[model samples]
Target: MKTFEARLKPLMIAGLDGEAQAWRAFLQLLRPALHAYFNRRQFQGDADVEDLVQDALLAIHAKRETWRRADPVTSWCFTIARYKLIDHLRKSGRAKLVPLVDDHVLLNDGVEDGAVRQDLAKLLEATPPRQRRLIEDVKLSGYSLAEAGERLGMTEGAAKVSLHRAMKTLMKRVADREH
Candidate 1:
């Protein structure tokens, strides 16, 4: 009996060579492995696991030309599966990375704190005075939108729009700085 890798290698090679039947068979063979792969990682449910598997298979098919014959097919397939799993986690809003240190500890570090403050000040400076005040009151000061709006003498809806525009401007500035 052939090992799973051995069984998959020929099919992958054939699939890459444009054999439609071989590609279909390769995907079929990969389904169970993909399911098991996702299950072991504690995917939300069977449905989620199946969805991830199907996504992985489709990605594998689409990116087939990028796979090198010199590499083990299993490694290539699992790499795609891992990427799909990560994407699913991100899309589902479950990809947060917990910090090792507490917020208090981070704040006390004092390293580059001044620089960070200066950078933020510069970013905030790019916005108009009213939008900047709204962001500071609502986002930095942790006030509710309604409270911020009342404090700024504007309706909550107007405050929200101003904050959104301010945030968009700040994001563009940050992206520009990075480049």
Candidate 2:
């Protein structure tokens, strides 16, 4: 796949820019390097790794203007990424070095549960756009019915109806999985 950076470089250079896309491209470019750094430093926990990556990306975007044009973008990105990783580790007290586990035990039953969760995520992704948005806003993100309705440009009653329908659909899908 052609990268966002590769596809959009000319536009960026011309100052006909996509700062958000540029940030996304920068994160994609930095992923491997960040992963290697975390692996080498023995960072554990999927949630921790994802949070660190997200925080680093946010900082990189915020500080993008400070990065020197003369310096290589990779180096600049890694520097910020590394600092973010270290900061998260320090704040969370999850930095203690432990002997690495080559293989971790997973309960045999967990495989089915994991598959169900994956399917649920996909099902949600495939949901009708408006209902999906409403469910995410009201249920997943804990937005109040009024708040969700306001954001979705609907009356609160309408939002509640839409959300109930969305949840019923999801429940039906999950229930069908058993059979």
Candidate 3:
């Protein structure tokens, strides 16, 4: 019985060299290890674990070119897996694990209105001038996109694109802050 590294190295190299069969076999071999890795992390259910395994595998495949032959394949693979797990935890709103004893204390006070306004202003300040105005008019003022665009001297389509980009940037900033 060969060690996992011995078995995987050849397949990984072959896969990188564009061997279709070797690539398929490599993924098949990785699935069980990936499944076990996620299961040990106590994911919500088998479905979540399986989903993460697939995500890790896809990431590994996509980033294959970045892998150096001199590095331990397992380390590279697990790094990708760890990132996928973190992304899943963040997107699922489970990145932070609160203790049961602290639950009551955590719920004591809601966010202050002033704090929310300050945070909103901070996020808006990072946007470009045009996008800032579009966000303010369309979102904060509750104006229709067309109305906001008319007020800002832009077409409705332009306003929509600007707002979408601004919102995406804000979301990324918030996600980064959370992590």
How many residue pairs of model 2 clash at the backbone?
0
In order, how many clashes per candidate?
0, 0, 0
lDDT-sorted candidate list, best first: 1, 3, 2
On residues 1-179, what C-alpha lDDT tens digit does candidate 1 reach at each position?
67677898899999889898998999998888788767767766799998998898889889999988976677678767766766787788885432211234234532223333445677788789999999788766679999999998999999999899998887777655533
- Residue 72 in model 1: shift from native, Å? 0.3
Q: Give per-residue CA lDDT, model 2, range 59-174, as digits (tens).
A: 86688677655544554555566567556766877635321111121122211222223344577897999999987787556799989999989999999999999988877774
The 0-to-1 C-alpha lDDT of every candidate, in the order given, reads: 0.74, 0.60, 0.74
Q: Candidate 1's error at 61, in angstroms?
A: 0.3
The TM-scores of all predictions, comma-separated, are 0.52, 0.41, 0.54
On the 0 to 100 scale, the lDDT of residue 179 in model 2 is 27
Q: Model 3 over residues 1-179: C-alpha lDDT tens digits?
A: 67666687789999999999998998898788778766767777899998999999999999999989986676578657766877888788885541111222223321122223445677778888888888788767679999988988989998898889888887788666646
Model 1 residue 165 lDDT score: 90
Model 3 regions more than 4 Å off? 96-178
- Which scores better on TM-score, 1 or 2? 1
How far residue 46's Cα lies from its native spot in candidate 1, in Å, is 1.3
